[model samples]
Target: MKMKVVCVGHRMPDWVDAGVDEFVRRMPRDLPLQIVEVKAEPRTQGKPVDALLDAERQRIEAAIPARARIVALDERGDDLSTVALAARLRRWRAEGDDVVLLIGGPDGLSPTLKSRAHELIRLSSLTLPHALARLLLAEALYRAFTVESNHPYHRE
Candidate 1:
């Protein structure tokens, strides 16, 4: 059995892979995390924000695995602690369902996209840069795995 985590991020830099990889390497083979980048819609002059978001949303939807549960990361989403996330991960594992975590670009995900989310989560109350958000999310997933596996990497 394989556990897959697909992150549909908008425009993460090449260096972002390094940070994400660091945590991923710490995880066991039973859980494999993968980040897939979707092309971020360009912000052209005079173009409406809605259009950009819509385009991005389409790209994101296209990238998602049809059977996977969708988890949207948004400012207004529910905040979870490390332990809570671990429990959530445990549930997902027990259910034998893969998950796709969506991270929108500057304009953010469209309302239509958000409405389809199985879980809406917030990493923090403060607005985070796209780069930092990638790193944080990657690490959080690793921490969640550690918590579930009784690994020493995470502490209460």
Candidate 2:
């Protein structure tokens, strides 16, 4: 099954794209990894944060593939080790459905969206910039795959 990172941001810096591309290139054909960037709602002086998040939530929901397992990335979510992630990845593949990992915008994901996720996970406890988080998630996924495949790219 394929995996997609549905992030609510666009026009990331060149460095972020280059970093993510490196991991994407290494992903196996059987379990391809792709990134889906949704436009972030513009923040205005009078607009409430909730309104902006709601707009992003709609875009995120629309970007998700039908019947796909949803995983929301949140700072408060479970933090899995690389090995644990590999096992989780294996389980996801066995389930025979595409998986989508949701990364929220600057303000974060709405409670409603997070509640709908099949799993909630975090890359770190510290709040990371969205661009950096994107790169980290891409590399972590690549490392998890390597661990699963017993490749030298990952080590205990």
Candidate 3:
């Protein structure tokens, strides 16, 4: 089963791109990881925030695979240990379904999207910028993979 990180924004800075690429390169081929950057909705003062979120929802939902297990990234979500993340990843892989991790934009995920997620996870308690969030997610997923395979990247 492949893992896909579905993000709202595209056109990351060079540094961010390099950082994400670095961790992604370390991911093993057995459970290949890929990134799908959906076009984020434009923020306009004229339109309600809900409207923008709805647009994002449509785009995100469209990108998701039918059987993919949705994992939403939220600040208020459960914070898991590296080992726990490894366990979840291993379990998802064993289920033989694609795992799709969702990353919302600056305004965050809408209630509709949140409600549809199979799980929600918070990478850090502190607020992080979108660019850093993607980098951290890439690193964490890579770490989870390493932990699952006993690669020594995560040490208790």
Please give the lDDT score for candidate 2. Answer: 0.94
| Models ranked on TM-score | 2, 3, 1
In order of appearance, the predictions have TM-scores of: 0.91, 0.98, 0.96
Q: Native-vs-model 3 lDDT?
A: 0.91
Stretches of candidate 1 above 4 Å error? 1-15
Q: Lowest lDDT 10-mer window, candidate 1?
A: 1-10
For each candidate in the order shown, give its overall lDDT on alpha carbons: 0.81, 0.94, 0.91
Residues 31-147 of candidate 1 have per-residue lDDT tens digits of 887777787777899999899889888888887876888888899998999999999899888888778888888877889889999989999999998778878998999999888
Residue-level lDDT for 140 in candidate 3: 94
Residue pairs clashing, model 3: none
Question: Cα RMSD (Å) per model?
Answer: 1.9, 0.7, 0.9
lDDT of 2 by residue, 1-156 (tens): 999999989999999999999999999999999999999999889999999999999999998989999999998899999999999999999999999999999999988899999999999988799999999999999999998889999866
